[model samples]
Target: MPTTDNQGSFLNLISIRRNQVTAMDNDQELEDLELFQKNVADLFSGFLASAEEPSSAKSGVETIDSPVTARDNYIPPPPLLSISWFRNLLDAFLCCEAEFKAVLVSGRDPSQFTRPPLDRLIPDLLERSIKALDVCNAVTHGVELVRHWQKLAQIAVTALQQNPIGEGQVRRARKALTALLASTVFDVKENSNGNVHGKSAERSWSFGRRGGGGGATMNNKDPNGRNLSSFSWSVAKSWSSAKQIQAMSANLAAPRGGESTGLALPVYIISTILVFVMWALVAAIPCQERTGLATHLPLPKQLAWAQPLVSLQEKIGEEWKKKEKKGNAGLLEEVHRMEKLAQSLVEFADSFVFPMEEEKATAVAAQVKELAEICEKMEEGLGPLQQQVREVFHRIVRSRAEVLDVLDPVTKLPTPVPY
Candidate 1:
């Protein structure tokens, strides 16, 4: 086509893309029509394809999205693949970004979405939002994701009269997911198997060394080869599944009569195999388990401080009512969720997986229950008239932090502080 015609066509395409983004604003429309996502892949593909098109002056074909311009081609972030059997979470990312974008287009700030969207997209949105936020959340300084989540929550509630994705649950989980994603570091290549116990790696000098470094051997004893537990073939295979695993070398392929084969014939051949196997397993255990705390544990430990928070919550509620007699509903609900989440934070910090665990878990669960209640209030309390309620929530969290010293993880006791 002519130069002017090419320019016009490109502008038309850009307009089409922008319109697609705009159309996605309504969650119901986006989900029902599947416009944004379907268009997203194609639009991005076109944008990438356009990069290959040379300048018209150089050849014949012209660009579409115009790679020469300083704009990203739009590769959506992939999801967390914390498993041996899974591939990239691009599916998860696409799903989540659509949800995030849908909420943002719906007019709420992306960070301020408080719940999953309605219009039958709640479950899918919740799953994607969690991971999509993880991309934004994968770093601490990036608080922008929080705004996105807050907006998501808002769109979800406004769009659905009755949502299958519980308003309170999504809010709490979103908050926790955001926190974990932001706080923890993500390691991509780490394995996900075995209990950790110190193990040594089998390295070699290979200077025509006395014994060859062993070849790759499967360690059934260790998922990560801690050798802390005995290896079973099924266990070893399961743990090392879908990963770049290590091998062990035991025997020498060299000539027994060779002059170079000097040194200690004093050792039993079988003993070397046993020694290498045991030690190798020990070295690999912890390394395999280090995908980061966020990957291993989802969100915060389910709240364990619910019961204690109930009475305390009532008191906080009364106190909030007294201090902030007037209100902004949205602010109030935000405050309430914050308070309960904060309480859950304390309880979760105190929890442990073993020994004296039941009590701590129970306490934490109670806190979660309170958090759930607060989430409900926050959802109901959203609007322009609940600002005071929000403040009350702040005060409650602050006061609770003071009342209960930080929970100690090891001892499972409240920290001793001057009270």
Candidate 2:
């Protein structure tokens, strides 16, 4: 019923209205994309700011200025916000992924969006998260740190599963986490093992040797029939005689131990004189230094009686050195074992691909959780061993101090007067 001109005008008006509707829709989509970007940026900024804050005692405690703590002595930071930042970050990532997919589905050119590219931005976020976690691990030595890292790693794994674009970053994070956990386990075991061995060595060193019998057991009486109480006196006499002999010989150019003393005293005469002088001195010295008359004997002959204590000290030193060597070798072995395990973990992570099947994903998750539990158990086991090591070390130090106190006066006894 309408005229030709009126129909044409109506079609033109409809076209304009349709164009307006399309423009409005495009504008709303742009605004939404912008809002999504701003939200992502704000969340990430907050997370980074929190992560960068210096970890001090104050972080775990409520500040005086906190409104919730105004009525209380002190309150700890809530577990949800303080410890669950990684989980929150992961949730943000998931949201970002969903928005990005929506943008793709809307037939809008992502390149036209005035924001950072998704490929670059997502990877950067993942990398920063991993670095933050690494800092957390380095600064803290608590099991809580391990647990938190594991949670972050699990989330990262999920992120990788959801979005393949950030796979490289996610893989790197997994490798780092695996390496950290492996090294921690290794260190705990190695330290515990070393401490155990050291404790055993300390016990043997302290209780096995007789205190003043020149390394003989208390059950074994001296073969020469000397009283135990007089052992220290005998040792002092021998040491003094040896020093005198050393001082006298300083001016002489004696042959080395295996070398012959050409045209010296006859062997039989030297031996007989040595035996006679030793008994005479022991009978007469009475823990006193021999003076003028005793200088008639040669320097080498005077040192004979001191040989037992010197030999005993040398044996003790050798035993200590052997124990040290054994401990070092054990530590090296443990380090190598850890290195191998870390390498295997890294390889596994590198080769990993997020399984498409639900069963496979669940299985992988289970395995990771189990590994974390094992590490936790190892840490717990090391606790008691570490304590034992500390106690043993203190005991050894105390016992040594006591022994030195007892021996100090005798060792510092005045040198015998030279003949």
- What are the runs in model 1 whose C-alpha is more than 4 Å off? 1-337, 343-351, 354-356, 383-419
Residue range 82-176, candidate 1, lDDT tens digits: 11101111232233334333333334332222221222122222222222211111111111222323343343333222223243544454455
Candidate 1 has an lDDT of 0.28
Q: For candidate 2, lDDT tens digit of each residue in 1-419?
A: 56998999999999999999989976876566555546544644554444445454234555455576453654332121222332343344445444544443345433322122323322222222222222121112222223333344444444334433245754665666564554344322122211212111111111222345333112224578754211111111122222332343233332344322211111212222222222222211111122221323233433332233223223323432433222121111122233344444455566666443566456545544544444454344333422332232233233333323433434222322111
Q: How close is candidate 2 to the true structure, as a TM-score?
A: 0.26
Assess every candidate by TM-score. 0.17, 0.26
Question: Lowest summed-lDDT stretch of 10 residues in model 1?
Answer: 79-88
lDDT of each: 0.28, 0.34
Could you give the C-alpha RMSD of every candidate to the true structure, in order shown?
Answer: 31.0, 40.6
User: lDDT of candidate 2?
Assistant: 0.34
